[model samples]
Target chain A: MSNPARAESIAQLERLVAALLAKGVVSEAELAAQQASTDRASPETGARMVARAWLDPEWRAMMLKNGTAAAEAMGVSMAGAPPLGVLEDTAKRHHVIVCTLCSCYPRAVLGYPPHWYKSFSYRSRVVREPRAVMAEWGSPVADDVELRVVDSTADYRWMVLPLRPAGTEGWTEDQLAALVTRDVLVGVALPKLPA
Target chain B: MNPRFSPGSRVLVKNDWPEERGPCHIRTPHYLRGRAGEVERVLGAFRNPEDLAFARPAETRVLYHVMFDQPGIFPADGKQPDKLLVEIFEHWLEAA
Candidate 1:
């Protein structure tokens, strides 16, 4: 079941795309290619970057300095995508991203924004009562830890580089990537060691 | 395009819109107007989205990573974090 307003909006978008295609402004092949590239990097792309950063200091530096470039270096196209800002979660600070106006996400790397991320409550309350909202996710940041809430209000989309969990000394990059779930990518939860 | 502010420079968001620019398809969020922040990074030049939204020739403008303190945005017994970053176009900023 879909809300009538949302269904109408989706229909309008489909019509617009169809018109663009009919006018040759966008070729069908081009449209398909762009759609494919839109999600070229799944959540695994973020995970791979984090895993590599954990293992390689230089790569970590690059990811911290310029997330878009770092993603491209990892063979992610990122063409026609907005600039990506990777917020590093550290011992002293934690990071969370929300677009108060709309769900502006780094889809090239993080795939699609989650459902709750686009909800009105999450968008509105996260900016005002981030701690309370975060607590609902069951990954509350300790009071001592400074929480940085990044609002992707413009063309810049943000993502979190979650801290590497302990007790995984000999874990391979693939294993580390496996630990990175959608929640971790969204900064609501942290990656954990396998039980 | 020459950017107004460089990375790491402090800047203030303009409280008011530019003269005679009718408000339609503006990208700068209302919450950030008149707010002060530091340019965390330079995002290079891009076609002005405000102009592009209206089907006009999109003049390029520099975009910056503007970082604001959470306390400054929301004060009084809140656990809202230390910083909030937003991407603002050069046109919306002035040297602090």
Candidate 2:
């Protein structure tokens, strides 16, 4: 499916990488490693964490209270990877996360943020316009809750575990896990009852 | 991109500077975008992530990865776009 346009995209990526290399902003080795990290355990670990948090209230509480500790508790260590952080959003105040300096995300806890998540529009606008962004994700205001935006930085990165949605009250942890969306885990959307 | 730049060039952002804005979608490290380096090399023919990310066919007009010194582009609040990769159109630059 790679036509001239697609070829152009690939070429652009090549030139961009070349530019980066000429500048030594990132080493060829590091860039190659990052480009190859797409298939590692980060996404698996991240998804598993969200799933587990849904099943265990204690673990969920731990994650909300302290992300690194909770991930470690779940056996998801960030030893060789970037640090991990968790931000929680509640009814009184909603939390939206962004890294305005770089895509410094908790790859150990959540996989690469969707390109849109780490965009100028998202980063630049979230803090100034949380309600608008959240609404787009279908996580609207409760009509009484305040909005709060959290900026994750280079030294630290964040992922949010949104408050559990209603509807399968007696459901097991596994059941709840099935309901959590990456957006929900990131507090961008709510996990409502299946439609 | 030049390794250095005249003072009148774009502001040079330090790598260690922290962003003050809340979570941003697009972030360029301050050091790259804010730092006013010379027009080191016009790496011709590439798509800016701003356009590429959005799949904007129109904005994909040849990207020139500009170079910067200690500081390039910096917002008053000290915010940085992703990688300091300013998706500037080539016309934005004026040779010094």
Relative to the unseen true structure, what is the C-alpha lDDT of residue B32 in candidate 2, on a scale of 0 to 100? 48
RMSD of each: 2.8, 14.2
- Model 1 CA deviation exceeding 4 Å by range: A1-11, B17-23
lDDT of 1 by residue, A161-187 (tens): 988888889889999899988778778
lDDT of 2 by residue, A91-192 (tens): 565556666655556666566677777778877766545566777878666645654444453234567666667667677766666676566656667678
Give the interface RMSD values of the models in order.
Answer: 2.2, 12.3
TM-score of chain B of each: 0.84, 0.36
Give, for candidate 2 chain A, the lowest lDDT window spanning 10 residues.
A147-156
Best by DockQ: 1
Residue B14 in candidate 1, Cα distance off native in Å: 1.6
